[model samples]
Target: EGSEGFSDLPCERYHLPRPMGRLGKFILPNLLLPRALSDRIGAELLHVVTPYGCAFPTLPVPQVVTIHDLSPLTFPQGSSWMQRAHFHRLLPLILRRSRAIVTHTTRVAEALSRRFPGIGGRVHVIPPGIPSLPIPAGAVPAGRPFALHVGTTEPRKGLEILLDAFREFPLDLYLVGEILDRAELEREIERRGLGGRVRLLGFLPDAQLARLYRAATFLVVASRCEGFGFPPLEAMRAGLPVVASPASAALREVLGPAVLWAPGSDAAALQEGMRRMLQSRETREHFIAAGKAWADRYGWERFCDRIERLYHAVVSGPPRGQGSSAPMRLSQRPDAPQKETPRKREIGTA
Candidate 1:
């Protein structure tokens, strides 16, 4: 959900006319388009935000790819067949050809290293910064206080497990995200008899989300796995206390002691954690204070600085077959007095 600190930053975005419709999102970009397009756009370093990109025939320039998770390979239930195949078959080729790889957590990096053993040296762990969402102007959404759950309807998100724990909570459980599987989720909610207690306020605008985040009693993240747990971290940034399942190594490493962790990933453990959070005033206060301090450590400036430096390092390095003494390109130019041509990077998703 975070954009690698690229939003509003001093970089150019190349908008190749994409085909219309939902299927076109992944189709035209990866299939029809060629790596020669990068040469046409004068791309010094091609950075693919996702792993499923063409690195086979080889790009004219060095490529840097960022892989968010290995969920398709490691946890098949969360992904589609297309995703599983792409990651399993093509991802190794992409990693092999990439000059540098970027991932938010060390957990994902280690996973990649294990999958493609000798590729470890190129992996870079760069944690993303939380967005400073606009301060919502209106009062919180009306009704009973909510235990907020913010994320997509992906199966790995553990919404079903959250459902089991939610059945016991006194408060309404508000889920905020784009509904990826409406029928499945609705049926599950109805089956559990949580139709009234649970509400799916699907895809609210950022302002409304901010209001909910600020006003929620507490945040609950019951994920089976997470490459990086954004909702828990985002909740902390929004000044909401969090009770999360320790399902992801990334979450445990990044948010230790800042959030109340469930004893296990099961519904019973989640319920216990929720009960403790809801019933106690001291636990809430402690996490609220600690969360803010931890969340503040991930500011936009530091994130952007690290990313930009990485970009410079990747682009300035010699070509794959060349010696280290090769000259630096214009992308490597230091930001300076008005005389030099300004450096720019064109961004496009594959």
Candidate 2:
């Protein structure tokens, strides 16, 4: 799923001309001249696992890049000035030079294509598989049922709407992950008088998180947008049901009927979704079965195998300029043998 891979395969190494500065990383095509390096090392291909929004300068070998999300571009205020500048100045150039682009969801693929036309054919959608979670060590349940929320405390994540909807409920609300918008979140909690009910358990280890996932009633993701809905999918993997607030197309297409979908992101709709999960045992059971089965399809073995095939296609397909113009769909599974993967598999990109 990332570029810091192919370590297990045999490879040669070379010394760069100079160490790159922070900004120099995004503009490496100018400073580092990777094309000259690749030529010297006999490299056949180059992969940027997390290029963010930078560097697709003309290169000797075909380049493949991974883009996590476009949240920074979509919500400019949420990101720093440096990020905005990089995306605006470099991303388009990077996209044009690359042989192919890899993304986690079709929603992102659609957004990328819509934002910058003529690149849809080069974008490949692949929902990455999760790594192994920490061993469960019970700490969150504390003898009370709670709704779990993971990731950052950004406004677009729909935390405000989730609190307004669930604050009146009898259960507790535990938010895990970093607190990016603390002032805003604190203000919301104060206004609602949810001092005791809402707990901001910031940055807990995965062991603690795994415990909460297993014991929670259900996972609620009221996000306005997501590249890949990890919490909901992981909750499903834990045999826990999920309720997504108008689950984005990326999630809907991947999750299918495995999650209970709220028609909107309003308090009323999310409240009703929670009500269904708490009151109806059948609803819980249905999503649990469907969710687990859906989650199983994203095992690391499958992701690695599929991505490897994509690499083989790129390496063997055509010259740097001319390759297949057809779009690739991930819904169909390949009948290839599974390879044991750790972190990322080593491939002969060079």
Give all candidate RMSDs, comma-separated.
4.0, 5.3
For model 2, the stretches where C-alpha displacement exceeds 4 angstroms are 1-42, 53-58, 135-141, 320-350
Instruction: Please write out the lDDT profile of model 1 over residues 1-350, one tens digit for every residue.
Output: 24545555456666566667655645543553454455456767667777756546546667778988888988898888878877877777777777778898899989888887777767788887887777878666577888999999898888889998877678888899978978888899989889988888998877888888898999998876678777788889888999999887877877878999999998999999988888899999999999989998777777667767777777786554311223223244376677755556665543
Would you list the C-alpha lDDT of every candidate in the order shown?
0.78, 0.74
Q: Supply candidate 2's per-residue lDDT for 15.
A: 50
Q: Top TM-score: which candidate number?
A: 1
Q: Candidate 1 at 48: error in angstroms?
A: 1.1
Choose the strongest candidate by lDDT: 1
Pairs that collide, model 1: none
Model 1 score (lDDT): 0.78
Tens digit of per-residue lDDT, candidate 2, span 225-281: 677877778788888899888845666777788899887779889998899898999
**Global lDDT for candidate 2?**
0.74
